[model samples]
Target: MKPLTPRLHGFVDYTACGLMLAAPRLLRLSPQARRASYALAGSYLGVSLLTDYPPALRRMIPFPVHGRIELATFPALLLLASETQGRNRIYFLALAGMVAGAYALTDWKADPDA
Candidate 1:
């Protein structure tokens, strides 16, 4: 995946999210950053679960909830969360969470085990 710009929100979210889940230990993240990573990872997990739900309710929840709670306000939240330090990194981290969520959902559908 290319390193997309801040303006390419969806793409950026996917790429960063994939990196966060796929390479959690590799990044030079802080304690707060770690928590952020975990939250993002959990969000991805939720996305994976949503696939099993009825198509109607699944369409109404999970990914959309993750988007609203995490991805949607992420950029602005990152700005406000300057208290956490590494604001820019956190924003990308949140985006990464969204990516991971999408990825997990994909894998869940594709996997023979799922």
Candidate 2:
């Protein structure tokens, strides 16, 4: 799948969080807000899948799942960067996320001939 833009991801995540906080009650969210919210959920899920754990039970299972955590953190960093605009952390997080994502995608995608 094609990747999402950093700003879009940020808006999505941000709006979703806002919606959740206002949940169980019918509320009006602007179209822009809704789009932003959906993207937010998608980004959050993607990032969390990369950076966070599946479950505590995974800890007891075999295989070095820490690799998964490290891999997932790339998306997390990107999301953080999106939120951290104009802040010092944004520079670092954005750089780290973009670099890591680029590396992972490139490394994962070998030539069909290869």
Candidate 3:
């Protein structure tokens, strides 16, 4: 069974968005990586806020669609990692792994009663 309910996944989504926003400063990433991180954080925040989940500001994107977006992000994260060095590479790789883990554990099914 998937370990993450929609509520839990929402919490993870918001948390990850915050981390992505802060990572550039915290990790002292290269300028290119910093820009990428900020852009990623903004996009991630937008997706989380619009996702059809408990913590969303609006319910435009279905939870399953959000999951697909997340799946699509894995490759992008890996590409960023490949182009970077040192802490930036490590951060992207770690973020990619974290996203993959969350995706693997989350339940993408819509609630029948919702």
Candidate 4:
């Protein structure tokens, strides 16, 4: 299948950030899990803001770099999910995996540095 365009990925990034931010409270997770979720949410938002895409708020970081980061982080997210417990964690992890997988398929190189 063809990869997602940068614009679409930008939308995904923003949505994912919102989901991560809300997950801990919505799922009633443990303190540690909650903290992790918050951290991930903040990080995602920061990255999204810095990404050089049409949807980015600030557009400081290059789009290719953002995609590479996304590709790199998925494994860690998977590991984190595997180490955690509860239905909420499982559901979050599953969605994260699917999103990351979709991100990996995106055409990160489509956008130029300029």
Judging by TM-score against the true structure, name the best candidate.
3
Candidates sorted on lDDT, descending: 3, 4, 1, 2
Q: Of the candidates numbered 2 and 3, which has the greater lDDT value? A: 3
- Residue 1's lDDT within candidate 3 is 79
Q: In terms of TM-score, how similar is model 1 to the real structure?
A: 0.41
Expressed as tens digits, the lDDT of each residue in 1-114 for candidate 3 is 787888899889899989988878988888889899889889989998998887889888888899999889999999999998889999999999999999999878847124
For each candidate, give its TM-score against the true structure: 0.41, 0.28, 0.94, 0.83
Ranking the candidates on TM-score from highest down gives: 3, 4, 1, 2
- lDDT for each residue of candidate 2 in 9-112, tens digit (9 for 90 to 100): 33333444454334312334444433444554454444533422232222232212323433565675566556543433444364455546543433222221
TM-score of 4: 0.83
Question: Which pairs in model 1 have colliding backbones?
Answer: 16-96, 17-96, 44-101
lDDT by residue (57-97, candidate 4, tens digit) is 88888887887777776776777778788865685586578
Best by lDDT: 3
- Residue range 16-67, candidate 1, lDDT tens digits: 5566565545666666665666666656455533422332224334433434
Q: All candidates' lDDT scores? A: 0.46, 0.39, 0.88, 0.76
Total clashing pairs in model 1: 3
Please give the distance, in angstroms, between residue 97's alpha carbon in candidate 3 and its true position after superposition: 0.2
lDDT of 1 at 23: 53
Residue pairs that clash (backbone atoms under 3 angstroms), model 2: 12-36, 12-40, 13-40, 50-72, 51-72
